[model samples]
Target: MASSGSAEVERDLTRDIRLEVSSSNRSSCQVCKEKIEKDSIRVAHPSRSSNVSIMKYVHPSCYLSSCVHFENSKCKSKCRLSKHEIGKHELRLTMALTSCEGKLKDQVFFHPPHASTLVRQLLDAAGGTEHTFDQLCVSLPQDAKAWARDALSGVDLTGRRAPTVEPEVKPRAPKKKRAAEDDEAESAAKKPRAKKAKASSEYFVEDGDPFCDGDQNDGDAELVD
Candidate 1:
């Protein structure tokens, strides 16, 4: 009975569900407070207590570190996972990201840990704008963008829906007249115009010329002589 119990314990220890991302923004990582930035991956692990399951999120690097904690007197060293172990988890995550459409479909079936999270990060980088996959691919980290491109290589994104960006139309400023036209108008206004001379008939007889007075005086002297 003890041997059977030990075997059962071993089986339970080996059993692990694949990690994924939260579908909504309702939850945060218990360990890191979800300090993970936008366009970054996350991992959600399942824990069961009294037959009820609860999920908690962490970074992939954090999760791996938690699995390899080692304390010793010699060198204070840390253990690392074998290539086979790493490959196994990597394949799981790759499958999860590729098939789940950037979200976890079910809790019972596992694919990769944090697979959906990585996809979600890539989607956020590409969403809500007119950016194509190629345009977005260059903005991300080398590993992340490469993984995203590979995951999407076999899938058709023609029908994929992204967030819509409302088009903004700014009012244009009123156009100003050309400098030549303005200068012409200003110069025309500044120049003085010539006035026409008044005719002799328009003048009043308030004063007479001296030559007309001399002619009158000579006529009066001839009359007196």
Candidate 2:
């Protein structure tokens, strides 16, 4: 029975976690809250909720130190600070809140650096003495107690929260509208030019007309001759 239980735990760990080279730099680390550059090694934790699966990523060092229960996760909704989607598979930290009866209430997600600032705010609101970082870590599940302690060893809880960056979305003209404008331009270019009308007082001088090349006086002389 003991061996069976151990094997089950190992299987769970393998199914939930993995390490791979990042294919792109679009994802940020949940631990250090920095971009995991392309082609770099990163840890992935698959989290599931309401039938949706989100892949959370982090740096290897951050994963080693963080509590297993508080493992880095992906943002499930729009970020409060950035007012934008943190994007699928982006790394984020999860803070779970429970009721007085120890019932799970809600969970809030934030960028790794932002999580630190929030902890500071919570402490300040509670008179700064009610809770400490160590105390908070102690409250978490002890699945990775030693690692959790190491994770917070040199972390700065008072450090400034890094700003959330909004993704750039360039507006594109509608295809129908663009096509209509192009058609209008093409039609205008293809229109035939209107021929100019001659004035009522004007007449064409034929090639051999007597007055075609000479003054009126010369034409009169030629007529007399």
Candidate 3:
């Protein structure tokens, strides 16, 4: 009975978030919907429902982008490093500080650069120099693991929030202006040129010869009564 109880406890412990290398390529990442290749690093979030445990795996970067980082979260308090009030709508990094029951008891907000520094301090306290980033992430507290990975990796969280929709600036229509110009051009093209009337003494002539009056010759040759 003691051995059986120990095995059950071990199984229960495995149903938690894990950072590890993939053993097979069969599992697809929940965030990007891509196959996790064998030997690649992956993040797993495990959940139990109706006595069955299910594990969802994602790539490290995908997991950081999808879960760990935020852009539009309002700051509720001062930054941990600067001790200045974070503006209500200002962009900030959020790290949840959870209780032993894994219930979130509080949150720590920081500027992006300051968040990185805090993560490094935590890592140094944990003797993180000897371990790779993945190993250090695994050693962090459960609540800190995701954000720690994000901070260390320098993931940009500025664009992850729900996008603000700006009012569309409809382009000004040029049809009215273009139509006015076209009307002016058409009027100019169709306008008649006024010619000064010539005196009767100026007979119509051929080849600029005033004496060679073709109209007078044709009229004089007409039959008379």
Candidate 4:
């Protein structure tokens, strides 16, 4: 009888826990082998093979792909609801409620810096002038609440969290305002001779040609060039 009860308890403890968006860059998805970024949604499943409980993580979309049967076969065969379906349904309910708060805050989603989805969702949902949010969380199904608790509690098989992805910053070339100013100054310095001072009488006697022989020769040479 004790052995049977222990087996039942083990079965009960081995279910998938919760869906969460990672708030840390420290871990990668077990399914896609890609870094799960901050604010990106993910899911957790407890491994049943070991005595010590271990959690495996994957992106939300990868849930179906990662798990061979996310929904239990027995449940499907019996046409009964499974813990997986229930957990996901509750998660979506929470997401919808969070989206409501996100809408209120004028954001597509409510995300807090360095905070997990459960924490961010709870805070965003509860931050308003209503106490209904608290009640809503309280009203969550036990399985759903378990998910939230496990995620927020930060329990994992490995003690380490994912490493942060530091943003790459490229060095920019310096703009040369001095070079532009220098160019302008050089252009100004090279200004056309003041219209030859209208052939100043004080400078020289009036010649038949407007330009002197030397000037005319220079002009012809320029035209040839």
Report the number of the highest-TM-score candidate: 3
lDDT of 2 by residue, 37-74 (tens): 99987767665558775667766555534422243333
Q: What lDDT is reached at residue 97 by model 4? A: 10
Cα deviation of 62 in candidate 2 (Å)?
0.6
- lDDT of all predictions, in order shown? 0.41, 0.55, 0.58, 0.43
Alpha-carbon runs more than 4 Å astray in model 2: 1-14, 69-225
Q: Is candidate 3 or candidate 4 better by lDDT?
A: 3
Per-candidate total of colliding backbone pairs: 3, 0, 0, 4
lDDT of 3 by residue, 1-225 (tens): 569889987876675345677999999986678999999777676644477767667676655444444343443467666677666555555554233475632344665545565444444433424534465456444555565466556676564431222345899877988999999999999999899987688446467575764444564576879
| Residue ranges of candidate 3 with Cα displaced over 4 Å | 1-8, 48-51, 69-225
lDDT of 4 by residue, 1-225 (tens): 479889987776554245666778777776677997887666665543347756656665554322311111121121111223322111322121112233311111111111244443433432444432233345445544444334334444154322222335799765799879989999999998575546645655366656654334454454543
Candidate 4 local distance difference test against the native: 0.43
In model 4, which residue pairs have backbone atoms overlapping below 3 Å?
20-42, 26-162, 26-163, 27-162
Model 3 compared with the native: what TM-score? Answer: 0.32
Model 2 lowest lDDT segment of ten: 67-76
* TM-score for each model: 0.23, 0.26, 0.32, 0.26
Sorting all predicted structures by lDDT, with the top scorer first, yields 3, 2, 4, 1
For model 1, what is the error of residue 200's alpha carbon versus the real structure, in angstroms, after optimal superposition? 99
Estimate the Cα RMSD of every predicted model relative to the unseen true structure.
19.8, 17.0, 15.5, 21.8
